[model samples]
Target chain A: MNRIAQGLTLVLLGAAALTSTVPTDLYLNWVKPGFGPFLIAAGVVMVLLGVLVIVAELRGGDQALDQEDVVPSGAAAAGDDGPARSELDHAAAEYAGHTGDGHGHDHERAPGVAWLLLLPVLAVFVVAPPALGSYTVESTGGSSGPPPRDENGSSRFTDNLSEAAPGEVVELDVQQFVMRAWVDEERELADREVELTGFAVPTEDGEGWYLARLQMACCAADAVVNKVLITDHPAPEADTWWKVRGTWVEPEGELYDASEHEIDTSSVEAVTDPPDPYE
Target chain B: MSERTTPERGSAPDPATSLGDTIAGGWDDRGDELPPADWGRSSSSRRTGTVWLFALFITAMAVAHAWLTDDLTGQAFLAWATIFTAISFQALPFLVFGVALSAALVAFVPTSAYQRFIPSRPGRAVPVAGVSGALLPGCECASVPIAGSLIKRGVAPAAALTFLLAAPSINPIVMIATAVAFAGQPEMILARFAASLLASVVIGWVWVRFGRADWLRLPSRTHAPNASKWEVFRESMVHDMMHAGGYLVVGALAAATLNVMVPREWLMAVAEAPVISVLVLALLAILLSICSEADAFVAVSLTDFSPTAKLAFMVIGPIVDLKLIAMQAGVFGWRFVARFVPICLVVGLLSTFLIGGILL
Candidate 1:
């Protein structure tokens, strides 16, 4: 029973890992894209291990059983004939020693606690939870903007912000928009019309919604929210994706002092979710 | 099954045999034969039961999911599930790599090799092991089983335990990730290395002074010398994966729940105070249970907290977190974890503050 449970658990986990990464891009919602090959390799290894276990059990069962009946009694009677005994007899003796002490090490079996592995197998294969959306952003209290500047008072994004020709709308992701809005000392985004895409999050006051996106370092578990308040535009339904053209509205504070960044929207259009939901 | 039971029944009536002798002799004779026959017989019966239970579980989940889909759309419960699945999925490959390496050590490496390499004295060996942690480049999940296997191979408990605490934090991959996360602040990377090394060594020394052998249930060595190395490797790898993966699931559940349920405002409220912020971030590290490689990015996001408090978060996270605590209790006994976790936590905090004060 324990052997079957162990083998089944391995196979199930392997299958779950494979299905998550192989056929679809479901794993992207959970981890970074670079993890694809590693997860697939791990899955193959697990499945091979599980199959090897079952095969070994089937092939060796009867022969080992026949050997067991003769070896133990023979070894016990001729206890002093240690050097004369075969290697199989020596292994049987070690197995006896393990079982003699109450700490019997079942070489082929797993602990009962291992049955809990079914939980993740069920979760991944059955529930199939979606990616983090507007709920996470609101719950985590929205974006804290970008990291502070270095001691030299320079920002990485400063040089990347090129001067745009007048009336040309620049395209930026929600992350870059929030970063420049907070740390860019030149106020480069203030006069330039820019385009950003994110899922909508309705504001509490019912005036205008926040355009929000989650940025993760490794996986969804460490994801943080980056959002911009879209003022003067009507609120869209929560979590619906949209592309908005807007000009940055300079807030009343020094850089990194303001809790929120606002953008005055010129136009709003409903759009499908992006291929990569996170930045 | 019937044929196997006949011998057992015949052997049971020996009046000359004492119960202990009968048990030991019977187990010795039947160990190879009975387990296989029993496994074959029980598996067929149990497989059906398992299949039925699984179908019922799926059906129930389908019903619940259908009912809850509308209400749970963009809700906290869905958020919790996403985080839980993400953590488990992200950690799974690293855990597999760790168990595979651990199994190789048990099967391929000779026990004598450990004694010949490590110093005899616990004091000298502890720092040696701590410094050697930089060799392993994987995250925290990989180190726990490797540490457990190191102890199994006769390395000193203090030295192996020190390796566990230090490997995840000071490794090259984690350091690079930290450097990228705190891009311009080279001091943060140096401080992390110094603080993690100091804390790991200090905790190892403390263990050498105060720890008891009986508190830790040393991992049992498996497979006799006569067994093939491939057989030993396969057996140990499967066993360790089953054992550790279950605990990983437990850790993921706790972290996910805390991630969704704990309000960000509470952490923000304490971010301004110097001493309280450090303590708060330390506690937050335990609760968040973020992987050490990714934790720097999360630390950078906490713009409200001081560099010292962020240092505490980074230091305490890799060494002592909900996931590590669960894995430790699974590998070592609960008694060992109860003592070991607190010691690591306190040492990690003190080392962080000391290093952060000096550098930042």
Candidate 2:
């Protein structure tokens, strides 16, 4: 919590931000793609502020002593519990008074909690945790269909599907496919051979598997699972990315409340993960 | 007046000193008091030891990095770490933006400017401040310190508190994001705006009428008397970031743990009940600590919940999430947050039900 520690924490955090954003796609694992510039800007500002703190401390040491003589008199005259003194100042004064004899610098120390900033810095650099995958999908009960339509019943997902010819193999994201299968009035996914890509999550029944991808609104923390239940195919190892050519198998009962949708696959191919993992 | 007029005379030598003099001259009237002298030689030896300690810690972490990553690849642990890191990374830039703005208020903007703009009376000022929250385009992370700075600059505490709650939720970016997330439901956007604004204003009034000044802890001013405004700006920015960022980490950790542990099915199971659904989602909003800009998508995904329930999620999120709670405790004393959060929650839920019932 001393000035040096505070400055170093900032520098390391800034460095972590810079490394995550600048030369790599590491940031995509955590946040959306648009935050790159903001991360970089913040990184620069943080590094600068940190360097300023350290430089000021090193060079202005003597000047600090000169000013200490002036602080207590002004603060005391402001009165111990007067409206003029902030609660923070009162706390600081008590802290200063308690440690006033040995640790003359206690007032300059940031709250001890500031040390916790180092945890994220260490987590980022050490763990380098991967993006959310099948574990998230399986645990979260995998993607619910898209947001409900307006009262007018306009479709948010099937607008582009109108261009697709019947019987053609149409490529779609796992999210788009789920929305069309469940809510689209056109049933654009029905009877069409649709190609989709996602990591695989085995069905709870152990019969087939779900091709799942996490759709993140802002960051991995808010990611929601979107998956297609691929029937009549062997489940791949969990989290393995695949492109599957399949046809939608309409559910027997009501479409809206069903827990999962079915897709009968004609083909499945192994593929590397996409550049942007989340939908 | 002379200081305002002769700005150029001070500019020729040191740009920082001149900028400091011109912008901070108003501060001179407040009776200068330098920051505590402990900032000087008292810590040199301790400083070296601290630096060495930091170096040792980093080296130890580097040594453990491979072993930890290898052993800690369990699914839940990985998910937890990813979410924790994501929340931290996503929130930090916004926190920095808040700190910068707050520091500028302390270092550059004069107290007189606040007096000029805001009405003196807490009742009138509260609503005006609530509406003005639309101007800040960022999320909740940016608003807390900005609110704290406003209080320090002599804005009515009630008004500043109003601005804090209202800014993150009613801001233009959040509104547009809500529109896009809810897609065709224009009413969702209107309802959120109305509910959040009303709730914040009501809470502000509650604070005004019954709130005690002693309960609030204004952020302490820190800078040497003769320090340049740039120095003040830099110092305060660093201090605020270190302070707030640490609490943000605590919030993010708690959120990640809950997010990983709590099953989505439990939420869906209760999505059928009318009253319980609203309360559960409201509580979930606090627990999830999802950013306001993104909470709409999360809300929209919970298609099983009633629209009013979704409205509760959106309205309460920016005002009283785990992260905001942690940051508030750091900025305002715990005494204030202890009283404020419960009242804010109740008012927010009431506003949501009223607006959502009428609109959705």
Candidate 3:
């Protein structure tokens, strides 16, 4: 019965291997989810092991079955000989010793628990995490409109960037916007041109603007997708690279909106994929 | 069937009885003198030769794999990640523990002491083994050899098997890692705890009821004589390091493959189906075979999946996965692993679903 069960298992494994190909992880997950590659490979290996085990069990059974078929008389006597008897005695003694009382040695085996030390060992290997920064602002669903601009066609780093003294035109560094999260108070910069670098993401609203830009928080898990609303400009192609100088404005709400904000679409330039492409 | 018949057809005395003849023949050749003191030298040398050859082959294959490939795609990444994970995971702390623990057993404690507590009946032993999970803490790599030792010591097979299944899932290290991975989300910890506990208990119960002890043969064969405690410790350590390390490498290679090869955008599109999305994330968890301690971090990063779905993935992963199943099968009997794995899976999933539903 055990042998039959084993064989059945092998057949199942082989069948699974042969027919499945949404990729093993995908297949396994669809059937019974797990960690992708590791789980798939482990499953494949298990099937292989099942095959080997079934073969071994069948062979053992075959031997036992054959032994039963043999006639049981003088044939057995020939097998019991002088030297063989002594060897058997020795074997019995060894087996007896094993079954006897020196189990203290088993206590020695507890050292395997020392591997619990590995948790600390691993902690030492992976680097310490850093603080979350500006690159994450837009992605966090903070502002909803065009980013705020400065006097000289550049977006102001923050609403507090020296207030541009009424009429003085200033060329703001595009990189400085990374330090602050855009808020509604900065919406007065509308029609004031400012340069910026970001990748284009398609928006379903058809108003020609959507949340675009690489999201990053700590690592990438908390990555916030920044919503960019473009009303006046042509619809940017999804996944295309872009360099645009646009005015800041307040736009209507969308997904995960925190501080409702918008962007007045301005001069847009389609560009190539950027080097080291991320905020 | 044919192969089985052919080996037995040789005109030889019953092999067990012929052992005496073989010994006597050796004595006759030596003119009744005692056997040589160093018979082990020849065997050891032969073993070393095999080991060296295997090492050479592995080195050659690794070099070729690194240099020869150019167009790495989805399949390739999967293969590599699996291999890497398997090798590294095996070598990591668990390997060290396997050796150290084995050594401690051999040196400090008497093996027979186990007889005092170990139950003779599978029925009683199975639960004890499963609940023993509360005691030993670590992942599958560390639990296996310990289970093997328990078996060699005459512990009920079902009980030992239960201990093996539960130890990895409920270990403190794994739980803590899960907690860190989920960060402020308290429910993640609860789900993992509940799921792992439930799965372990179910598997233990099944083993007690239907498991056959005769299958635990390979582990018993590991009882070869070497030397002192240092030798046992060193040999076991080296053995586990190589074996577990090999599996870790396989696992990592598989994970890296998935990360680089599969298109994430396509997966995201598929994520629109919430049921499929949860299942997909769970599958990724298994494939990645991240150590239970680290899986939380990976689970947290998957932004597309719902928190409840991700919770299921985290909960189910450590207890059951492709890599763990494969490793367990190798160390334990396939029959045992097969029975245990399914039971655990069902229990783990159910527990996670209930907990996640309540929390999320």
> Which of the numbered candidates is closest to the native, going by highest TM-score?
2
DockQ of each candidate, alpha-carbon based: 0.25, 0.34, 0.03
The runs of at least 3 residues in candidate 2 whose Cα sits more than 4 Å from the true structure, single-residue gaps closed, are A62-107, A151-155, A165-168, B1-42
TM-score of chain A considered alone, across all candidate predictions: 0.80, 0.82, 0.36
Per-model TM against the reference: 0.85, 0.87, 0.49
Q: Once superposed on the true structure, which residue ranges of model 3 sit more than 4 Å away at CA?
A: A1-279, B1-91, B112-137, B222-229, B238-259, B265-278, B358-360
lDDT by residue (A123-232, candidate 2, tens digit) is: 77788879999888888764455655553443456545567787778888888888777776555567888888999988888888888888888999889788888878
Instruction: Between candidates 1 and 2, name the one with more favorable lDDT.
Output: 2
Query: Per-residue lDDT for A204-253 in model 3, tens only?
Result: 44456543554321122222344455667777655566677665653445
What ranking of all candidate models by lDDT puts the best one first?
2, 1, 3
Clashing pairs in 2: A143-A225
lDDT of 3 by residue, B1-360 (tens): 333432332222122212123233222312211223322443323323433443343344334435543333333332333223223423243544553575465445555576666677767777666667767666666676676556655566667766776777767777776665555567667777766666666666676676555444322222224345554444344334333433443444455445435555565666567677777777776665655555665566565677767776776677666667655644443565567777776766676667677767
B6-58: candidate 2 lDDT, tens digit per residue: 23322321222221231232132111112332435445445656765766666
The C-alpha interface RMSD of every prediction is: 12.2, 8.8, 19.3
lDDT of 1 by residue, B73-141 (tens): 547777888899889888999999999999898779987788898997989999999999987898889
Off by over 4 Å in 1: A61-106, A149-155, A158-160, A163-168, B1-74
Candidate 3 at B254: error in angstroms?
Answer: 4.3
Which residue window of length 10 is worst by lDDT in model 2 chain B? Answer: B13-22
lDDT of 1 at A27: 76
